[model samples]
Target chain A: MLERALSGSQRYWSWLIFLLVLMAIGFACYLYQFKVGLKVTGMSRDVSWGFYIAQFTYLVGVAASGVMVVLPYYFHNYKAFGRIAVLGEFLAIAAVTMCLLFIFVDLGYPKRIMNVVMHPTPNSILFWDMIVLNGYLILNILVGWNVLAAERKGVPYSKWVKTLAYISIPWAFSIHTVTAFLYAGLPGRHFWLTAIMAARFLASAFCSGPALLVLICLIVRKVSRFDPGKEQLRTLGVIITYAMIMNVFFFLLEVFTAFYSGIPGHKHSFIYLFSGLDGYGKLVPWMWTSVGFGILALILLIVPATRKKEDTLAVACAAVIISTWIDKGMGLVVGGFIPNPFEKVFEYWPTTPEILITIGVWATGFFILTILFKIAVSVKEEVAS
Target chain B: MGVSRRKFLKISGLSVLLGLGGKAAFELLAPGSIDAAMEPAPIGEGKRWAMVIDAKKCLEKQEKDGCKECIDICHRIHNVPNFGNPKEEIKWIWKETYEHTFPSRHNDYVSEDVHGKPFILLCNHCTNPPCVRVCPTKATWKRPDGVVMMDQHRCIGCRFCMAGCPYGSRSFNWGDSREAPKELNPDFPTNMEYPTRSKGVVEKCTFCAERLAKGQIPACVEACAKIKVNALHFGDLADEESEVRELLRHHYAIRRKPELGTEPNVFYLI
Candidate 1:
């Protein structure tokens, strides 16, 4: 099946080459960061976490979003998702790999990462997050591969594989929920102290994950003999639409609670993100841009006629992904840090090396995604022929 | 009903692995036992070690000419580098304006002396330290004696603790802490007994845990005592006769961000 990936057209090979080049450049930037400390990044004492952490946070959602498809298919016996379920699982595999990489790059002592495993602190949410993420990744791989393999052979999957698939449904939710807990439980960081944080994370993740899957399936349909089918796409579009609406609603709930309650500690973070608080509003523009994307996506997704069209739905999906990415990766982690516990805004802007290393990690994820998709699609094509 | 040797071995192996894992997790999760095992606190030492600051004296001295004797001594003894860049400033003890130090504690309609005066600030060493709580690697922990100790060697530099601290006391070594000038600054490592920190680790005032262990007062307290202002006080709150408790009893004192419920051990006599 992997050999089929090697025998692709000129365009596929070129795309793979392009990603490899980016990976090389990003790897070089990472080496530089390793030599010099985190000083290469935009992070300081005040804003301790920056791009690396935000990316990790966002990708966890993308990884956990695999559950949206798995849940409907396995539990509800939704036959439409059967054709493309493996791709969703593969997407999770790639996303979780990126999440792990992002955490690795962010660590001040990357070597001591083993200490997390060796001296596991279950009391720490971070320690639990590490366990769940790795577990989720392994679970997705096992279920996706076994099922895909069983399908290619034109046989029913083993009961063990079915059991693993069932376990993956809840495991997917755990990964993102634990990621949210990593932030929500913190004491001083008022921005992440809300109870709805996990809810918001799940809402956004469900939408964003399926939205990405829609785009990937569209690509798969266009490039390969494997058609993910129209029924599947329409159903996924609906999922994305509903999830995006819920995500936006969840966000506004946070806004309402913060301002209505009149807690200065809570209100200031939202103020800093939306309006300039104390003349420090670097993120104000980005936050508004995210809001614009979210609203635009809602308009496209909510309308009956527009949601029916694949091209328009693709555009809506792109909007959701962009908005959620900015909201989660850029705004959430950085906003939580700003108005540093002293109530003074310490702005963060990722440096050149930092940006390059981030790009490298994304490229690496895509590289894994490309290979996995190629294998899955190839296997499907093999069975079809 | 029919258990083959192969199945039996596989199940037993998995169970053994699971048992070991469960034990390991239980050990790590066991909060009290791990805390007790790690730092066998000095015998006969009363718990709840607290600090009290005489802010009125600090304000008067600072209002005349910035009296940073405590800050200077702590930096020297701890070897906290002067990075000069606010973006990368690594401070254990520093000065803050009265209002910034205490957000909801008061307003502009306060007394003229206390209103806009500078106040010395450091780690509150919270009794319920969120920094200790969120530490992914138990690299930082709250001792029974109330000092929140950070193991720099063990710290993965996640900066979770920095974010956890509400008082903005913690600092990360963005650049190498040992990069400070040995020749240019005569007092860089004023005390050879104190260990210099490396890059990429978070650090803050330990209430001079090493000095306390040596049966000497914290460098800042000793420095303040020498100046005769007696603004800084450190003692066990459990001891009824302790000076810190005595100061708190007489004066209208307050801790930073008290509403946050971190139960900051550091108190100020306003």
Candidate 2:
């Protein structure tokens, strides 16, 4: 089986070459990040966390969304997801890998991350977050690899792998919920103080995550013989639609709470991000673009007529992915920081180094995903043979 | 009712995987067993430290300066860097604005009536603190005698306490603070009473835990006492007969935001 999978790898030479070149460029950017401090990023004293943190927040959602498939298939016995359960697991591996990269880049000294473990703060949500993220990543990798190995060997099921899948279901939810707690538990940041933050994060994660997976599956099918079937796509599409609806609902709830409460503490962040705050209208256009794309994506996905067509669905998924990336990722962290504690407005724009490093980290994740997906596809072909 | 081997294989395989994942999650989610090693000893017979700020006696133009003497003395004695940059300031104690530092919701309409009068601010050393509540690490904790103290070594620099602080009292060490003071000033003695803060750790006023340990009042309190302005006072809030408690009853001393339910030990005579 291993030999057969290796033989299948030979066909994708051009794709492999392209990935290598991109990786080379990404590595070059990363080299610059190491030489200079995080000062090169768009981050400032007021806006301590910027693009890296935003990306981390988004990717954690993506990683956690894998459980949507895991839970339904294992607990409720949804068989339509059978062919692609491994895909979700593999995708989680990639997503989690990216999440860690974003966090590492966000850290002042990536080297000091180990201090978090050696001198652990058991009471800190961040400490718990680290434990959960690392645990989830390992659990997914082990289970995914073991299951794939079982199929390849034509061997009977492993007892441990089954037990591990059950753990990963709630573990997935924990990763993102804990991520939300990192914000919600903050004192002065009124926008993030609500208990609904965890729910909102999960909703957005579910929406964008499945949408991204569906798009990837379609692309894989187009470029290869790995068609997951129209029915499977349709089923996942329904999940995406509902999740996106909830995500949109969660965002609207935030706006309603902010405007209705009329509290300066809460309303200020929203005004700063969406409209102009203190004559600085930088995020206004980006925010509006996100809203426009969000509505467009929701319309395309929710309506069966539009969602039924593969091309249209792909476009909708891509649009939602970009919008969610902006709304939840970029806008969320930066917005939280605006109209600083003193009610002074501080603006943040990503510097060239910040953009380059971000591009590099993103490319690195893609590079890993490319290699990982290639291996998975190769293994699946061997099993089918 | 017949199930194909292929279908059975998928169903059972998924069930097994699900169970394993749940078990793994349960392990990670389970809270760590409480560390019994670091249990606090019973409070000994020592001066229970507290502070009194005579708001009226504080100089109008030199409001922060009066507070600064205490802050500078304590920080220098304790080897804290005067990191000049706002970004890198590691103030164990400092002055704050009427809005941020003192923050009277009533003061919104009343700040003009009390112009040029800014109260001396420090860690409330709250009997019950919100900072301690949200702390994921037990780094910032209230001592038995009501002094809020920090274990710098244990802090992960997550700054949750900083965020939880309504007073905006906490400051994060954004850069290396140890690089300051060009020449090692001889007046300050460095001991491991608190760990040297590394970059990314959050720090705030300790209420001088080491001074209290050595039967001395906090450096700020001593400085205020020496200046003879009768503005700063310190005593054990826990003791009913303590000066701080007696002053609270006799003089209409008020704590900032008693409504927040933190029960701050620090009090100001308005």
lDDT tens readout by residue for model 1, A1-385: 5676687888889999999999999999988887778888999888889999999999999999999999999889898898988999999999999999999999887778787877778788899999899899999999998888899889988999888899999888898899999889887788999898999999999999999999999999999999999989999999999999999999999989888999888898889989978898989999999999999999999998899899999999999999999999889999998788777777999999999999999999999999999999999988999
DockQ of 2: 0.17
Each candidate's fnat, listed in order, reads 0.75, 0.23
Best by lDDT: 1
- How do the predictions measure up, each by TM-score? 0.92, 0.81
lDDT of 2 by residue, B137-179 (tens): 5778876677777876666555557656756567766655554
State each model's TM-score restricted to chain B: 0.81, 0.72
Tens-digit lDDT track of model 2 for A97-145:
9888777766654555676677566666778888999999999998888
Query: What digit string (tens of lDDT, one per residue) describes model 1 on residues B180-260?
Result: 545645566566877787777888899888877766778899999898888999999998988988888889998898877
lDDT of 2: 0.75
- Candidate 1 clash total? 0
* Global fold similarity of model 2 (TM-score): 0.81
